[model samples]
Target: MPYINVRLTRKDITTEQKAQIVREITATMQSVLGKRPESVHVVIDEIDPENWGYAGELTSVHRKRQG
Candidate 1:
């Protein structure tokens, strides 16, 4: 079984977009590794910007500075 994890900061992501992501990932596994679509697992994790950090600062803080 192939497992995929997608992580992103909390934002306006639609259900349709998530589904499309899952579909494409599964297809890629099938094409590249010969893994069955049914055996591929995709998990999406949405984290609050405040909890995600980069460049020595939180993403939420970074966005506010950009604005």
Candidate 2:
């Protein structure tokens, strides 16, 4: 069995896109890692900009500065 955790900042990702990611991740594990699709687990976590930060600043602030 394989467990995969995917974390990303909250963005404009659609439900379809998330499903694609899950499918791809599971398929990759099954094909390359020899793990069964039924045994592969993919978990996605979407963090809020305020809760997710980099370079000593929050993501919300970073996006504002980028604008």
Candidate 3:
């Protein structure tokens, strides 16, 4: 089984975009590693910006500064 974890801050990502991500990842595993699509597990972990940090600051802070 190929387990893939996709972590992203909850933002403006559409439902179709999320589904496409899962489909492509599973396809990659199936093609590259010969893992069956049914055996490929893709987990999308949506995180709150306040809880996701980068460069010693939270993502929410980064976005606020950008705005």
Candidate 4:
């Protein structure tokens, strides 16, 4: 069995997008690790903008600065 954890800052990504990501990742894991998709566990974590940080700044702030 393969355990996968995916974390992302809270954003406007649609459910379809998330499902696609999960499907692709699961396929890769199944091929590379020889694990069945049904045996793989995928966890998607949606983090708060204030809690998720990068480059010494929160995600929201960082994105705003970059944009």
Candidate 5:
């Protein structure tokens, strides 16, 4: 069995995008780890902008810095 935990900041990403990500990740795990799709569990966590940070800045601020 494969268990995946995905954490991301809440932004403008769509549900379809998230689903696609999950599918692709699961497929990759299935091929590499030889795990079945049904045995894989994917957990996506949408974090708050204030909670997720990088480079001593919150996600909202970090994104602007990158851009």
Candidate 6:
């Protein structure tokens, strides 16, 4: 079995987008790693911007600055 974990900042992501992500990742593993789709597991964890940091600052702060 192949397991993949994806982490993203909580934002305006939609259900369709998340489904596409899981499908693509599953397909890649199936083709490249010879894993069965049924045996593959993909997990997505969405974190609040305030909980995610980069460049010594919170992601929320970074996005605000970008805007």
Best by lDDT: 1
RMSD of each: 0.6, 0.8, 0.7, 1.4, 2.0, 0.7
CA lDDT, every prediction? Answer: 0.95, 0.91, 0.93, 0.87, 0.87, 0.95
Off by over 4 Å in 3: none
Q: Against the true structure, candidate 6 has what lDDT?
A: 0.95
lDDT per residue for candidate 6 within 3-64, as digits (tens), equals 89999999989999999999999999989989989999999999999999998999999999
Q: Model 1 reaches what TM-score against the true structure?
A: 0.96
Q: Which residues of candidate 1, in runs, are more than 4 Å off?
A: none
Each prediction's number of clashing residue pairs: 0, 0, 0, 0, 0, 0
lDDT of 2 by residue, 4-67 (tens): 8999998898999999999999989978988879998888999999899899999999998999
Q: Estimate TM-scores for all models.
A: 0.96, 0.93, 0.94, 0.85, 0.81, 0.95
Q: Which candidate number would show the highest TM-score if scored against the true structure?
A: 1
Candidate 4 overall lDDT versus native: 0.87
Q: Which stretches of candidate 2 lie over 4 Å from their true place?
A: none
Instruction: Kindly give the stretch of ten consecutive residues in candidate 1 with the minimal lDDT sum.
Output: 1-10
Which structure is stronger by TM-score: 3 or 6? Answer: 6
Off by more than 4 A, model 4:
none
How many Å off is the CA of 57 in candidate 6?
0.3
Off by over 4 Å in 5: 63-67
Lowest summed lDDT across 10 adjacent residues in model 2 is found at: 27-36
Which residue pairs in model 3 clash with each other? none
Root-mean-square deviation of Cα positions for candidate 5 versus the true structure, in angstroms: 2.0
Query: How would you order the candidates by TM-score, starting with the best?
Result: 1, 6, 3, 2, 4, 5
